[model samples]
Target chain A: MEIYLLILLIFMIIGSIIAIEAKSLLSSVISVGVVGFSLSIAFLMLGAPDIAITQVVVEVLILVILIRATITMDNTAIEGGGGTFPFVVSLVFFGLFLVFSFFAVQEIPKFGEPLMRVSERYLRTSAEETGATNVVTGILLDFRGYDTVGEATVLFTAIVGAFGILRRRGRKKKTEEDAEKVGILEDEDIKKDFEGF
Target chain B: MPDIDEEIRDTSKGMTSIVKTVVRFALGIIVIFGAYIVLYGHLTPGGGFAGGVILACGYIVLTLAFGRQIALRKMNNKAASILDTSGVLAFLAIGLLGYTGGYFFLNFLGRGKMFDLVSAGTIPLCNIAIGLKVTASLFAIFLALSIFGRFISSLVDEDE
Candidate 1:
């Protein structure tokens, strides 16, 4: 437990430092991924492996998209560095919260007893009732399927937004191409407009 | 089948040929595994999202080994968009079925005995729908990226 806390502390410190000190936008993005990955590990140790896996997968997808966007855009052009002032403020707030959480952690009843109680009563019946061996899956897809539908909608929205952003410029180009072919636009004007793309 | 993009590589190089062969073989294997994962998602530890991601990864590998034009030739934009829309439609249809059957989104469609590989009521169908939607959405995003990235790069070069 001490070792885990130490590792968490180390990761937090490194994550904060990287978020503050990294020169490139890509490095900062990676630093955030590292922080998220460590938190997922912490979730695992806290007996939430299913949550850990989901968090890790979501983090990976977000990180990949963020990194790709950062690489493709002009990230280094930001004047004062990547929002360092807000970072420091948030870090301080998070640190204070952590210190307070340690004190409050003792008073909180852990998951052990409740999980045990619930598992004893519900584990066997969940499969028979829901037809899923994995209780978490049953809970996610059966008991709380409405919530899953909402989650799927959120994912759908994100993909739609990304598709829109990526498609808009391409569609503009296609229209311009058509205009040039039909002699509605001059070659030089089309070239200049294309150059702005 | 169409003119497609000009072959960006010269076919006269032995080293390039070896690399191309290896890449094609790897991509083929990846696509197979991804398809298997998607098909057997409910019967195993895997599920729709994971399988869809695996399939997308395979598509990406194939795109790298071959090219966007060839990969898109098989998974054209129209086909992918249709699959994506249909998957969502299927999900909504199932939910409506549940509502009609006394509960919202309940697995009310039972064809056979419980505990059978294919008798998970609506779970397997849901998984397949999710897999199709996710794979199509991912591919659509990637297709836009590839096409737009190339377009943007060309613009930058033209200004120079």
Candidate 2:
């Protein structure tokens, strides 16, 4: 199991590298999808089915949205500039991240070992207290209800903002066109003639 | 003859008939499955968010297979906005209902037998509400982004 997880992690790293280095936006999106799929599998192997399910669905949705966005953009422009400075900086950051994560991984409890008090209490009492068999749901919707509300609010705000920006841009374009036509009309006798008609 | 052929081709803006037919056939099952996941969230590994995503995928499939215009006609931007707001409102109302029991988001309703469908009281209700909110919000986001992309592309075309 540990070996399988290690292999999966390696594959995820490969996927991420491909995603970053790919020339085309579509290929990068696909590589990122691969990474997301591997992460979902890791979640499943780690006994978090709910997280795995959410991850898979969210990954698909993100891929679809990204593909749609990229399809409409200039394909050649998706190929980013090759800059050695940015590359070197990213490499240094990657090395630091790797070293930090290696030490952090060492601190985590071994596989199958229960971690501390909170989870134990949640497992024992959540069913009875919340009347929900799924302790995760109970914790999310009951014990941590405030957090869920905050999350929902955030999602709502993001969608509203996106919708507002898109709608506003469209209206702005139309208004600008109308203003231009009005300006053109202002300089002519035809403006008064058209108004009278 | 060329004009007639062009008009015929314009009738279906999506993929081939096989893809559209398959998606049309499968959409109902996908929606039903999402509903099942949401309704049985208390007893299953999936919940509102997961089920909501699945439901949104069903709409996405519809959009992909039948084009944006048809899908938008089915659930337009205005309706989606209304649904999105209502979902959050429903969830807030459910939380507020707990005020009668002395706490916010308290499960005031009776807890039925364990593992039963209706046993998880406000939990299933909350899941359903969240499912609605998530589905509408995701679809709305997708629609907005895609429409924006199309508009931008059209502007680019005009400029060119």
Candidate 3:
């Protein structure tokens, strides 16, 4: 299992590198999807099936959105070579991250070792108190319900923000076109309506 | 010239009929599976988020197979926005109901026998609410983003 995990991690790293380095936007997106798929498999191996499922679905959505966004753009415009400065900066950051992660791994509890007191209590009493067989769900919905509410609020805010920006841009374009037709009565009426609002 | 224009229009919209037929057949199964995941979330490995995303994927498949116009017509932006708002409102209302039990989000309803379909009183309801919210929100996001992309592309085309 450990060997499989190690192999998958290596594959994920390779996929990330390819995604970052790939010239074409579509290929880069597909490579990123490959990395995401490998990460989801790693989650499954770690016994987090719920996370794995969510990760895969989110990955697909991201891929779809990315493909849609680039579908109309000129492919040649998206192709660009990596500059020396970016390469050097990325290498430095990679080295620093590696060192930090090495120390972080040392601080983690050994495999199969029960580490946190909170998790212990959750396992002990979650089923009885929450009537939930799935302890993760119990903790998320009952024990940490407030946090979940906050997460939902964040999602709501993001949706509202996206809608606002898109709608504003659309209205701005329409008003610009109306401005171009300044002499026309209908355009004047539209401008008056906009000003009234 | 007219025949060529018609051909270009048809080809520009969606894929071949075989792809459409396959997507149509698979879409129903995917939706049913997602519903099962949301409904049985308390006992299964899947939950509201996963199931909701899967549901959104069903719409995505429809959009890809039958063109965005048809898919948007089926579930328009206004309907999606309303559903999104209602889902979260229902969830908040359920959470507030727990206030009567002396705590916020407390499981106030009767927790039926363990492992039963109706067991885990508030959990199932919360899952369903979350499922609805996630599905609507994700679909809305996809719709908005795609529309924006199309708008920009159209602008570029007009410029040319």
Candidate 4:
């Protein structure tokens, strides 16, 4: 199972890179879906059923959005090879990242003993204190509620930024269009044919 | 688009309108699942973020398979904005409730029972609130992006 899963991970990573680099928007979207599915499976194997389920659900959603967005996209810009300098820089950066990861992994302690001690310490009483069964929930909501609040705030900021840009554009468009005697909409035939978004 | 459009048109021809309609229905069902996942996230693996994305996915799928016009008619941009705003308000209200009870954002609400899906106190409520916010916000973002892209593309074509 481990070997098979490793192979799947390789395939998934390679596929995702290709998807990200692919010129055809449709194919790229499909590849992203494939990557999402594979990652969900990997999550399950890692004994994180909740994470896996969430990942799968979110992945499907993102793919759908990407597909819809792609419908309206130009899809003309295909990534071309960078000049030699940039290529060399990227190679060096990637090599450094690999070495850092290797060192980090080697320095990490074994997961079993530490996790067991922590669970033994607070697994039962944790839910009682936080009023949640899932110890994870207890930690996230009760112990780290501050962090959660910050996270939610981050999400709020992102929404506000996006909303501001879109709302401003909308106001500009409406005002401009209102000044005109005759409003010209996109051709009905073209509108009907448009897909995805 | 000359080549790809032909390919897409040919591929889509093999797919029937019935298939698209069925897909739309499925999307509605998916949205329900999203609601369930988020509302009961305290007990389950899924939470607001995952569920919100799922809900957004449902709308996106319908929009893609059918058209933007159909999506606008069904969910509508205005209604989405309302949902988005209400979600934020609900979240703030819950957080403020914490102050009156004791600490801010307190889950003083008792956990009703264990292993029961609804047992987790304010956690579930927070999940639901976040879920709503996330769904609306993400949907709004994508809708704007899609509309803007189309508008710009049209402008470029007009210039040419």
Per-residue accuracy of model 3 over A1-197 as CA lDDT, tens digit each: 99999999999999998987777877888999999999999999999998999999999988887776766666534545779998899899999999999999999899768687898899899888888787778888888888888888898899888788765365454555565677565756776768845
Residue runs of model 4 more than 4 Å from their true location after superposition: A20-25, A75-79, A111-122, A167-197, B1-16, B151-160
lDDT of each: 0.68, 0.83, 0.82, 0.72
Model 2: residues with Cα > 4 Å off, grouped in runs: A76-81, A98-114, A168-197, B1-11, B151-160
Worst 10 residues of 2 chain B by lDDT: B151-160
Candidate 1 stretches with Cα past 4 Å from truth are A1-9, A36-122, A169-197, B1-22, B35-44, B111-115, B149-160
Q: How many collisions per candidate?
A: 0, 0, 0, 0
Best candidate, lDDT: 2
**Residues B22-56, model 1: lDDT tens digits:** 87678778667666655554445556676676667
Model 2: lDDT equals 0.83
Per-residue lDDT of candidate 3, residues B29-141 (tens digit) = 99999999899888888888889999989998887776666677678778989988998998899899998989999999887887787888799898898899999999988
Which tens-of-lDDT digit does each residue in A52-129 have in candidate 1?
755665576667656656766754544564478888998999999999999998787774545466666566676777
The Cα error of candidate 4 at residue A118, in Å, is 5.9
lDDT score at residue A134, model 2, on the 0-100 scale: 86
The residue ranges of model 3 lying beyond 4 angstroms of the native Cα positions read: A76-82, A100-105, A111-114, A168-197, B1-13, B151-160
lDDT per residue (tens digit) for residues A1-197 in model 2: 98999999999999998897788877888999999999999999999998998999999999987776776676534545769998899899999999999999999998679685797888899899888998889889888887888888999999989897776365443333565677666546555445643
TM-score of 1: 0.70
Q: Whose DockQ is higher: candidate 1's or candidate 3's?
A: 3
